[model samples]
Target: MTIASENTTVFDAVTIDRAVRLGTATLHEAAGRIGALPSQIARITPGQSFAGPAVTVSGPPADNLWLHRGLLASSLGDVMVVTVGGHHEAGYWGEVMAVAARSRGVAGVVIDGCVRDSDALANVGVPVFARGLCIRGTDKDPDGVGGVNEPLTLGDVVVYPGDLVVGDADGVVDLPAARVDEILDAADARIAKEARIMAALRRGETTVDLLDLPKETR
Candidate 1:
């Protein structure tokens, strides 16, 4: 069910806008507080964030050729979600790829591996979320076991092509594209509820009182 009909639009402008506004945290809450990728995968550019349909890529350890293919296969507003078979030290992405991605209108990237060229990546205007940075380069093995636009499991979250991928400073979360409307509705309600709670806190209500937790016993 991850792959949908070719006629189905990968993502809509309105949905991307709303999802980016709500952010990964709110959408995760709306998704029953699940589908969060590993916390180690975080934003490389401090203020940058993105929300777009995923173009999942699975690459072999220490190899990045599939990522290039994934980038080529993607259209505007696609987020490349890649996993590199537990190889965390290779610099699988860098400034050059960031420049190319920005030029092609890729919304962002989330990889379960490392990236390098911090200075240029921070300036290239593409939001990248990865495990960490590394100086070691990667290979482009033609015989490597990898595929573009395939399902990938990063940590406990399963990412499939066309799923909505949202990433912010907190982390990344995958929301099912088919449930975008439902998730948005629930996120709206949660925001309203949290707003009321914030108002209550400003009025001097304690967390225990607001949440109705049992009183502490000596």
Candidate 2:
């Protein structure tokens, strides 16, 4: 496979599943293997241990009509990632949307804005990561654009419609579709090396010895 570059764009689910199944630690580790870009919402429900394709939505600051539409259009085993033009105040997701997403077989949601209904979301057990929580509601006056299977900007990172999104308590990561195989191999090597280092530690090895650090010149 060709090396994935900054401009390469694709969202192959098969490659993503291979990476996830190789035991890449967590979503955060898999992200690190690709590139550290997606941010965590500080506090949110833990994500399910499943990998799937991403469906992206982008629109005006306070409108979420497109989000609702996107939810209805999404297929099974998809994660709805929304970019609300960086407007961090109004709540873009809540109990109703979560329920709808779950019914559509969506794996979870990652939004660059606020969300509401923490208790309900916890009870439903559908993962949601956002900038924060707020009671401020959004407007139904539909505005802005919605793109299915399109490239979008999320925070400082660029995400394509089908890019692999691996998110957990640590945060969310966007892996380029093309380089999934290479990154998975790298993560496997990393885990094996860490295991050996851990075994040495259990045998009473010091940090300096385990890490091969030079002795102090004192």
Best prediction by TM-score: 1
Expressed as tens digits, the lDDT of each residue in 70-187 for candidate 2 is: 6865767777778777778888999998888888878778888889888888777668878889888887654455544566777567877667766655567776766666666776
lDDT of each: 0.88, 0.68
TM-score of 1: 0.94
Candidate 1's C-alpha runs over 4 A off are 1-8
Model 1 per-residue lDDT tens digits across residues 74-100: 778989999999999999999989998
Write down the RMSD of candidate 2 (Cα, Å). Answer: 5.5
Best of the candidates, lDDT: 1
Regions more than 4 Å wrong, model 2:
1-33, 46-50
Q: All candidates' TM-scores?
A: 0.94, 0.81
lDDT, residue 46, candidate 1: 77
- lDDT comparing candidate 2 with the true structure: 0.68
